[model samples]
Target: MEPAADMETASASTSTSASASASASASASASASASASATAAVGAMMDGRLLQENALSWPEVQEICKELEHLYRKDAQKDAARVRALARKRKEISAACQEKKNTAQQQLNQLLGNVREWEQQSNTAKARRDELAKKLQELEALKREMVAQLERVRVDEQSSKESLERLLDTYETARQEALKFQLEHRNEIDRAKHFMSLYAAVTGIKWDFSGDSIAGEIHIPRTQEIVPFEIDSTQSNDFETANALWAKIDAAFDALDNNDEL
Candidate 1:
């Protein structure tokens, strides 16, 4: 009985050990399968990284490198064209700015000339105004002088008129006196002629009157007037006195005529 029990116990133990060993081998196989799947996923990710990092295989990445190179070349050409355009635009702007500067300079010069001309014109105007002012002052002085002269002339004219009136009155009185003197002289001459006629008759002497002076000549009782004649003392005296009176009256008339002329 002891030997049979020991043999059964040993068999049971051996079966348990074989069962544990099989379970362990199944667990290790499952772990190894999961590890293999993880490795495959890591390899796919590595290939994507290689392509993204520009580490592609030669033949596979050839067309992609060519397309990238073409895009880079096109961008470089575009940048070069933009740079040239910017250079041309800069040149045109510089030229335009220079032209504008020259135009502004010319305009400034013109403005300066105009300002100078205006100043000259203003000076001339001021000079002209001063000259006119002086002329006006002179004219005012002349006007005042003319007015004073007019007043003086008016006063002189009034005085001259009064003097002329007095002179005219004196002249009228002188004319009346002259007329009276002429009438009296003629009366005296007639009376002397009558007296001479009486003397001639009484003395039996021939008497004759001749010329503007009315000279009287006496002759002795004559057979003819053409014969030589003689005047007596009385006749001579009467003739001389009459002649002298006539001469005096003539001189007075001559003086009056001279005064009228003046």
Candidate 2:
């Protein structure tokens, strides 16, 4: 009985030692598993926090947005510059067109002025031609009047020449008839001279006969002074012969007075 109790007591001590060793190994495994789970939970919490920061308030996103804004501003500035250049080019083209139009207008005005000057010159030439034509007509009329007057003067000169010739012919005929009548009456004149001589003896006067004339010497009854007298009878009328005879007697009396005074 004593041996059996001692064995049983040894067995009991071994079993307890085994049980304690197993329990210690299990406790170590549980602790290791718990540590792995805690590490996993912490890793998940950190990943969630990182996702929230990226969505709401990350510095890299803010920097990216600022860079995009800068690019947009640069593009806008380039567009504005292009627009300004286009506007400046359009303004230059319009200014060139306006200057060209002004030059064309000036040329048209000069052409119109030249045409007006030419028309004025033509009008002046026409008026001068009209005046020259009028002067020619007046000269022709005056020449015709002068020609008519010359023709009338020629006709009057011809008539006067004919009348003068007729008057000369009549004068020549009258002179010839007077000379013939004096020759035909020569005998009658001699008989008259003889009777005159007989009367002169009684009247105390001497008589002498010449061609168409008589000459005599007479004695004055109161003083016995002798006087010479002459008479011309070549005219056709008695009044002409009587006036010539009386003029001769008056001349003889004047000679007698002059002799008495001497």
Candidate 3:
């Protein structure tokens, strides 16, 4: 009876080990499939983004979407051009500032080396106090000049950094404009949503605001729709702009051919 019980226990252990191994194998296979799917999606994501960008120009892409977005991302392409120009200028200024810093450091190192050498000389001629004083005065003058130059360079660096930040802000706004262009040229829903988003962004209106309604911090005009009624007489610049954009949207849709898809 003892021998039979031992055999049964061994069989049970074998079965458990086999089951554990099978589970591990299945998990590994699933993990591999997921990784492959993710890799495939990642590989095509950039291409899809490009296509989306291209789809913005009148519902059909004519040029390379990447280049088009880079060149004309914002109104009149002015902001895009400014970003490129400012980026180059920032690089140049940064390089010049770095070079100035490096040169100042080198000059300081050389002066210190000279001071050490002078100290060695003064020790050899302990009776020559006047000569040592003259050398010390000269070293102090060099140190003062180097410090002034370094201070000027640091101030310039800081100013350039601020300008770069401003330029970056403009560039980001322009980039968002380009993204909107892509959405505007997409299907009908996206095209309409783009206008709604624009209205919200420009007017700071997050919720529904009819004419004569107050939305959080925004005071809206009385209207049954998002746009103000008879916007021609509306004193609000935001409504005027929204109405203009909405007009263009309507015209574009009206001009679409019967067989044309978004």
Candidate 4:
């Protein structure tokens, strides 16, 4: 009996130990299952948080992230090419602008030269004009002087002509007076000669009484007249008459000579 009891007690103890061991194992399994479930839940929450933060569904996020990476690489490559192209364009524009500025400067210099040349020509033209004006003035003055001299000469010529005309008139008057004086002198000489001839005829020398009586009568008698007997001195009468006639002739000659002298 003792052996059987001991055996039973051992059996009981073994059974109890086995049951406690089974219970502990079961609690451990439950704790392990709870931990696994918590771990699963935490993993699901992390996945949801990651999906919310990325703002995409799992498959869409994966594709979008891959495409974004590819686009970024492409954009970087395009930016590099664009930068190179812009640099090249800038260089070309700079060179073109510099060339344009150089051309403009050259044109400005040429224009300045042209302006200077034009100014010089203008000055020369002005000087020539001034000289021409001076020469014209001098010519005008000379012309005026010549005109004045001509006028003076004309006046003098007119005065000389008037003086010559006056002298000619005076000469003509003197000549006319001389001619009148000569004519008067000739007339006086002719008158004296006629008087001398009449006196000589009146004083005849040989006086015949019959001829004388007949000559003195208004009507001459055709027959010869007889001498008067009372005429005692006929010869003395004739001599006296002849002497008076000679004296009258001499007196007449002297009168003619005196008239010629005067």
RMSD of 4: 41.9
Which of candidates 1 and 4 is the stronger one according to TM-score? 4
Model 3, range 8-113, lDDT digits (tens) per residue?
5555655555565556556556655665665566446646856675444533343444444543344235445545655565565556556555655666677688
Q: What tens digits encode model 1's per-residue C-alpha lDDT throughout 154-173?
A: 99999999999999999999
Q: In candidate 2, which residue ranges exceed 4 Å CA deviation?
A: 1-100, 175-262
The candidate that achieves the highest lDDT relative to the unseen native structure? 2
RMSD of each: 36.8, 41.9, 66.4, 41.9
Return whichever of 1 and 2 wins on lDDT. Answer: 2
> Which is better, 3 or 4, measured by TM-score?
4
Q: On a 0 to 1 TM-score scale, where does candidate 4 land against the true structure?
A: 0.45
Error of 4 at 60 (Å): 4.7
Query: Tens digit of lDDT per residue, candidate 4, span 104-148?
Result: 566667778888999999999999999999999999999999999
Better of 1 and 2 by TM-score: 1
Error of 3 at 12 (Å): 99
For model 3 the TM-score comes to 0.24
lDDT, candidate 3, at 58: 38
My TM-score estimates for the predictions, one after another, are: 0.39, 0.37, 0.24, 0.45
Clashing pairs in 2: none
Q: Using TM-score, give the best candidate's number.
A: 4
